[model samples]
Target: MTITTAPAGVSLRGVGRAFGDHVVLRDIDLDIAPGEVVALLGASGCGKSTLLRMVGGLDTATSGTVRVDGHDVTGIDPRCAVVFQEPRLLPWRTLAGNVALGLPRDLPRNQRDSESRQWLGEVELQGFADHRPRQVSGGMAQRTALARALARKPGVLLLDEPFAALDALTRLRMQDLVEDVQRRSGTTVILVTHDVDEALKLADRVVLLGGAPTGVSVVLDVPGDRPRDHHQPELAALRSELLAGLGVPRRTPLERETHAR
Candidate 1:
């Protein structure tokens, strides 16, 4: 199989979407450079997932263009894949089968399993390949889904809170795994999440969406080193900024004063 770098990142011009009368996203323009990791950060109902859906071609933009690798995604691309909050794997299929399902049908059986095994190894789950989804833990299932997406060698990987359901420890491990995989694969990634800390830790740029018909509010450049400490001072500050941008209220002066004494 051939792997091509995503063309000129992903460019969005006047991208907008709505469901009947509910306008989810307003005029938005953004550019994600090739091999860049961008996080779409916002509170519930702020349309972060809507934007991701549009970018993924799972949903159409009510207005404007959604382009990936310089090609308009009027429909899903075989080269771009998504992993949602749920593992969404077939219960009847083994982990290896699920991963190999993404491979082109023309590939010989050996080549397909070889690709799946390599991706599973990347996530440290090579031994679980023959297990069914129910036989694995939530974290393991999520890892399988991630591996399935990676096995295809997609130019873009759209993740909508892929680790949200995992335990805190597992979530951190998955975050580290994603960082490592993206570094090695150079896959352009767009992750959508409500967790400020998650966004700060995973993305090169964190974009905050705000207001009734949500639109881009603040775009923060996360320049901290990769595999960054989630407890780092700079990340803490960035998290605070992101929380504020989402209109999350801060403590009152009275509370501050009381604590100060």
Candidate 2:
């Protein structure tokens, strides 16, 4: 496992999104340092996915800017890759085939094969190279999906609850695999998760997205230490803090208007 450090610094300025009359996000301002993993935490309908989409260039913000490592990604850039909740692999393709998809066909055959094999091994799926997506277990399939993302060696990785569909034990193993891989590769990661423990275990900073328009509700910095054990006392405390933040009651629009007056 060659631990290649990733450039993770990110800045968002006046970022917002809306669908017709529905404003899902409003005036989001955040800065994530290089090599940092920031967890976007929120309840369902809080626009966490919308925010991540804007960052990943899958969806454009209705307004404002999203910059990764100082470059705006209003469109997909070769510098970043996204791994969605489902494995989303082609049933006809083998594991190596899926990863090889990340490379340009313009590259020579030998080079592509080498790159694909290296990335698959990096993701700990070396033995499953010839298996089709359906032939592998859920965890193994996800490993291939992850390998596909990393084969390109992107500066940033966007994960949208990639392990949500797995069973509890598989999810835990995937979580550990992610931590180990990210630590070794140093890829800047932005994860959208509803699980507090998941966020606490992996994020350098956790930004809670809430409010009717989905404003940044709270930003909690996990303070224990690098590669912090998820079972540690301080990390557990931080998870409690996040849960408490989520439990904060939201006031009605009329109440907010009244208070403003």
State which candidate has the highest lDDT: 1
lDDT of 1 by residue, 78-99 (tens): 6578899999999999999999
Q: What does candidate 2 score on TM? A: 0.90
The per-residue C-alpha lDDT of model 1 at residue 177 equals 92
**CA error at residue 102 for candidate 2, angstroms:** 1.8
Model 1: per-residue Cα lDDT at residue 189: 92
lDDT of 2 by residue, 1-261 (tens): 364846667789999998999988999999988778999999987989888888878899988999988989868767777888999998998889899987665879888877788888987888888889999899888888888888767688888989989999999888888888888888898999998888888898999988889899899898766566777856655666677778744444455679999
Model 2, residue 158: what's the lDDT? 84
* Superposition error at 1 for model 1 (Å): 12
TM-score of each: 0.92, 0.90
Model 2 poorest 10 in a row by lDDT? 248-257
How many residue pairs clash in all the candidates, one count each?
0, 2
**Candidate 2 residue runs with Cα over 4 Å from true position:** 1-6, 248-261
Misplaced by over 4 Å in model 1 are 1-8, 250-261
* lDDT score for candidate 2 against the true structure: 0.84
Q: Return the clash pairs for model 2, or none.
A: 3-184, 9-34
Query: lDDT value for candidate 1?
Result: 0.85
